[model samples]
Target: MIALTCLCGQVRTELGKRPDFIHACNCTLCSKSGAHWGYFHPSEVCVEGDTKGYCRSDKEAPSAEIHFCEQCGSTTHFTLTADAVAKFGNVMMGVNMLLADERDLAGVEVRFPDGRAWPGAGEFTYVREARFIGEG
Candidate 1:
């Protein structure tokens, strides 16, 4: 199990197990927020504390809602929006791997998928190749 906590200690999430992998998507929101993502189902994780969520204001129907710490403003996790849930049924949740110790992430692969040009419903074009968390 792994635990992720925000800088202010106001929000915390416990992942039941190690994530399969993490993504570093190069998109407007992700790029600006500086998030390294580890995806899982909500059942695989437990969250505590209050977080404010933000969906893309630029899109008519944003797919996911980004969550952050209410106190220190640290990006924590994301859940699918209601519109997205209706289609996808809350199948995915994303945690900010940047909150964990690098050593804890050890051999997990970090993928650089190009979300900027992603079609939003299919596989993404990888702008950069994948790398393990600890590679020299």
Candidate 2:
């Protein structure tokens, strides 16, 4: 299992298997928040802590919700909307790399999604190379 925790170790999560995909987003909130995206099946994961959800009605797509830790103001995970759940049971976990341990990211793939042009709602670039097996 891949374990994830907040900077202060107040919040914790266990990912049952390697993520289906990992991504780095350059969107306004993502870039400012400094989180590495890890996508997985929500049903295969377990979380423990005080987490809060935030949604941006103006820019959010049909299947995504941003989640953050209340105590440390750290973005922790993102859940897919109903549409996405029906299509792919993938939940995006916004892992705080700084807090992840080496064993927590074993066998994980990493990619980059060009959320930089989120303002213009342009196309996004997803990298196929690059993977993370340990804490960053």
Candidate 3:
């Protein structure tokens, strides 16, 4: 299992398994938060502690519920809404890798996705690809 906590340790998250993928996105929200997302099913993660939520809306997609530590304001992870789950078949959780312990990142590949032009974008322009800190 992989464990993560907010800057103030007010919020925590746990992943039952290694992530499917880890990637940095250039979308507006991602850019602002400076997060490298580690994607997984919501069922594979557990969130604890007091978290404040912010729902971000997009014209082309469902609003996502972003949760952050209420105390230190550090982002923990985000969940896709029920409306999005219906379309996607499951809820996708994007956990912030920055909060993870370096040892938990073993064998994880970090990819870059060009989300700045998302829906209308032709193809992603990957800037870098590498195994994360603890990856062998």
Candidate of highest lDDT: 1
lDDT against the true structure, each candidate:
0.91, 0.67, 0.79
Q: Considering TM-score, which of the candidate structures 1 and 3 is the better prediction for this target?
A: 1
- Using TM-score as the yardstick, the better of models 2 and 3 is 3
- Ordered from best to worst TM-score, the candidate numbers read 1, 3, 2
Residue pairs clashing in model 1 are: none
Candidate 1 lDDT (Cα, 0 to 1): 0.91
Ranking 2 against 3 by lDDT, winner:
3
Candidate 1 lands at a TM-score of 0.95
Q: Which stretches in model 2 have alpha-carbon errors above 4 Å?
A: 60-62, 82-98, 118-123, 126-136
Q: Ten consecutive residues with minimal summed lDDT in candidate 2?
A: 90-99
| Estimated TM-score for each candidate | 0.95, 0.70, 0.84
Worst ten-residue run, lDDT, model 1? 119-128
Model 1, backbone clash pairs (residues 3+ apart or across chains), number: 0
lDDT of 3 by residue, 1-136 (tens): 8889999887888889877668788788887876788888778999999988777655556556788888988988888877777877675789998898867776677877777766653777765565565545
> Mind giving the per-residue lDDT tens digits that candidate 2 earns over 1-136?
7677887777898877766656666676667767777655567767799889876676546556677788887788777766667776554444444446756556666667767654455667653446566535
